[model samples]
Target chain A: MIQLLANPQRFMDFSKWAAPIFGILAVALLGTGFTLAFAVPEGVEGSGGSGDAIRFLFFHPQLATMSMAIYAAMAASAFFGFVFRHLLADAGARAAAPLGAGFTFLALATGSLWGVKTWGTWWIWDAKLTAELVLFLLYLGYMALLAAIDDETKATRAANILAMVGVINLPIIYFSVYWWNSIHQGSSMGGNHLGPDYVAPFILNMLGFAALFCALWIVRVRAEVWRRKAGALAVQAAGKS
Target chain B: MSGLGVLFRRELALAWGRGGGPMLALPFYACVATLLPLAIGADTGPLKAIATGSSWLALALTSLLSLERLFERDFEDGALDLLALGDEPLEAVCFIKCLVQWLATGAPLALAAPIAAMALGASPGLTPLIIATALLGGLGFSFTGGIGAALSIGSRRGGVLIAVIVLPLFAPPVIFGAGAISQAAAGLDWRAGFALLGGYSLFFTALGPFFMAAACRNALS
Candidate 1:
């Protein structure tokens, strides 16, 4: 499979088709997900249980789920690049950084918005928020490192190493919430904390967001590949002149 | 002594002798350290906090400012290739070079902290801890900065590139070093903070050389 995709021509062909399909699917899923997310019976928890259960979707659980899922996808792309030596895999990882970063920024932004509503403050130095901030910076750093290096081969390998290092740091960032008294909440997605009542829309949003990420990632990767090709051609033309 | 010792001495000599690297770095560190407090106003509490941080931050910046000179000259002159193929382990050589670098840049900055500390109105008791943390933290900066320097070899805009790659990793040291002085100033137990700084230094000290050497070899190849 890796060898088949290793050929740039084949990968380009695949992306030419895959990009549009994913983009269309992303639009559909995002439309459906948002409608369902907002349309869910409001104030269902109503004056009786846990203050307001409907508002829960707008808070930590959804954002945390999106952040982790994006990172997991990035890590998977990085692993594929590392093991299979696939250029598309590496390109996929490179392309995913900015998208993942955008999602992280969204998570942080929404979390802060939610905090302002609930905690009456714009920002809190809670462990989870800080860790997520660091994760965002890690993505920015990876992207910067890729842009900084001149040689394509060198940049890919350097960025790969950074992404792998970041994956290791992600767990540390997650666990730091427990290790310290941060303003961020503890795990809400997995284990005993995630009950069935909340799991449905959360999973829907995760799938929708993950698909959105893939759509963006495919578009970005195709753009990068084209840019590189154009750059090589320009260099060759200059040499010929 | 081993080949590492010989490399260490040679690097130290190159860094410290007349017209040596430290001549430029020492003045840079002094100027920056003095200029910061002036920029931030003379208030004692903030000054003292900035004072401690500026000590390590200045060292980190100066180390970065001078980092391109680390591998660029050697790389341009083809000396790095020889070192890559040399009998001594490149990792050990890398470690020694980092030590020499810290001595040349970080050591002077550490030594100069007291003057800046006084200027910033930091209490006398915090001076020793500031210097100690600077020394250890500066060593870590040198090691990590060397890796960034090595990675950016042969690249355009190497200076900015090195800074971007290195500054994030540099955060832990700055936090711990600054935290130590702040805790001490607050009359809390600063030993734990200093120990954390020391542990950070140890972690980077062990890990940096191998990664730096690998980066160098990759660049050379």
Candidate 2:
């Protein structure tokens, strides 16, 4: 399977059909999932659940998990890109970042909105929230490194190293925040579970979002490959002229 | 090893004389410490409360000021290529550069941290702990910050790129270092934070140069 996707042209060909299929599937699944989430009751008013905004659950967990899932995927591809030095792996890793950033931004924003409703404050430096913030910064750093470098191969190489370093650093960041919270007065904002009514939609939405990420990632990777190919072709045509 | 010593001494002298003078980061650190009071008004109590944290933060920010120049001039002027092609391994080159950086910027900042803290209204008793934490925390920063500097060695957007690269890596040391002082202030087991701070420095020491060398090689290639 890895060998198969190692070829950029083959990967592009496969992604052509796969991207739209996942995109349509994601749309249908998420559309139904949001409708189901709204139908869930606020669950006995004054309870710690985020009240009517409890519906935000469907978006938040999936976004949070998907953002992480995408980082993990990006890091894995980065590992491959660096170790194997394959263009497809580099393209996939590069393409996953902006989509992952979008997911992470939404996760942080939605989670904060949920926090506002439940915690009675706009923000608290909870460990989980702080960890997410760090993750978001990590993503931003990767994108910035990618954008700043003039050479395509060097940019990918440097960004891959950063990604690898980040993947290692994530656990340390999380653990340090966790320990720091424990030492400080760790706020117990505990009512953020998918309720019985919300469970089905939450699961469905998570799957949908995962599909959406996959579709976008494939599309972006294809675009990168085409961009590189066009650049090579332009050089070759210039040489002939 | 002697090669490392020579490199370290040379970098230290060069960095010292490069801009305004030796220990340029100190005034930046002090100036930052000074500004916090102005920005927040003459509120010593609140400033005192955050003295340890703010000083460490100032140290981190000030460290960034000098770091983009750590490798940029060397890479641009081709000094880095000669160093890479020299007798010492690139890893050792990385290690020595980070050491010089830590000594030139981080160590002095560590020694000056207590003064900065005092200037920001911290009591005299917290001075020793604050200095210790800053020294170790600053050490960690230099090592990891070297990776950032090396990675963005010749980029046009060097400073901002270096910050973005190093900021996330800076979190653990800041947390551990500040936690130590705060724990000491609270009359708790501050040694645990101290141990973690030491561990954080050692963690970067072991791995930081490896990454730096890789980044330098990438640029060199």
Candidate 3:
């Protein structure tokens, strides 16, 4: 797969077919995931279980999980780009950043909304929230750096370094919940069974979200490649004159 | 000792002797520190609580604002390419340049912070801690800023570009440094925070030179 996509022409060829497939998958999975997220029953324990259990899906665990998963995908693409020097991998990294940023915004916004509902506040200086805010800033920093540099190669290198550095903050962000007396709940995905009722939708949503992320990533990568090609052609035409 | 030490001293002297560089940073820092209280209001209680952090943040921003010119002048004059290809290791040279930069920017800012702290209603006992934290934290900023400056050479709006690249990396240091000072100002045990700041300074001190040199090489190439 690496060898096949190493060539730009071959990657372009592959993307021609892959883009529509990803687009369809993304739209389908996202539609399904949101439906399940909103439409599914609140489980048997519902209003009777620990308030923690009742409020779990409102913000903390699900959105946090999605945020981390999106970053993981970006990091994975970045690793591929760095290790193999794959153009497609670079495109993948570039594409995933804005989408992952959108997820981060969702996580923060929803988390804040949940906080307001539960804690009677819109925001707090809790470690986890602060770290997520920092992650959002990192994403903005990456986008700004990419846009600032006129040279694509330089932009890529600068963005690549920023991504690598920003990824270091993720572990700190996750552990902030554990390390401090944060209002954000501990991970629900860890430890023992999630029980079939909750587990099924959780797993399905995660899978669907992951697929949706992949599809969005592929679409964005194709657009980025085409933009660069167009930019190159414009430069060439200017030189001809 | 001879080559890098000589280079180091020269860089330090050059950065210091240039009246505008170090002097310019001082007023910028002072103005920024003074403005925060006005913006946030003169409530002494909150000002006292945030004095240390506000001062450190002001210094960080001032240092960052000045960092762009750290290598830009040398690079433009073709001195950086020569230094890159010269007998002295670029990493060692970069390390020395950053040391000089910190001495010029961080050291002076540290010296000046007490005035800002006093204006912000900081207690007398907490003043030294603010200075110490600024010095240590400034070292880390200069080192990291060197890497950013090197990486951003020849880029548009290089100063802002370098800050965007460097500021996030500087977050841990800022947090620890400001926390230490804030704790001290609040009459709390700040040792742990100070220790963390020291650890970060040490870590970045060793790591930054390598990245800065690599970036300088890339820029030169």
Which rank order by DockQ, best down to worst? 2, 3, 1
lDDT, candidate 3, A1-241, per-residue tens: 8677878888879878887776677567656655555554553332322344333453345566677677777777776775566777788878888987888898898777766655568887777677787777777777877787677766666566657656765564344333333222443222333455555556556666666666677778888888989988999999999
Q: What is the lDDT of residue B103 in candidate 3?
A: 86
Clashes of each: 4, 0, 0
In model 3, which regions exceed 4 Å deviation? A13-28, A41-63, A72-85, A169-196, A231-241, B185-188
Report the TM-score of the second chain of model 2 against its true counterpart: 0.95
Better of 2 and 3 by TM-score: 2
lDDT of 1 by residue, B1-221 (tens): 97777777878887887666668877887788778867987677787666666666777787786787778778898988988898988888888888788888878877776667666677787778878887888887887788777777777777888787777667666666777777787787777667866876787688878767766776776
Q: Local distance difference test, per candidate?
A: 0.72, 0.86, 0.73
| Cα displacement (Å) at residue B126, model 2 | 2.0
State the lDDT at A95 in candidate 2.
96
Off by over 4 Å in 2: A45-50, A191-195, B18-22
TM-score of each: 0.79, 0.96, 0.85
Docking quality category of candidate 1 according to DockQ thresholds:
acceptable
Candidate 2 docks with a DockQ of 0.78
Best by DockQ: 2
lDDT of 3 by residue, B1-221 (tens): 68887788778778878575568888898789878988999889888777777887887798897688888888899989888888989888888988888888888888888889888888777777888888898888888788778777767778888887777777777777777776666567888778877877876789878767766665665
Docking class of 2: medium
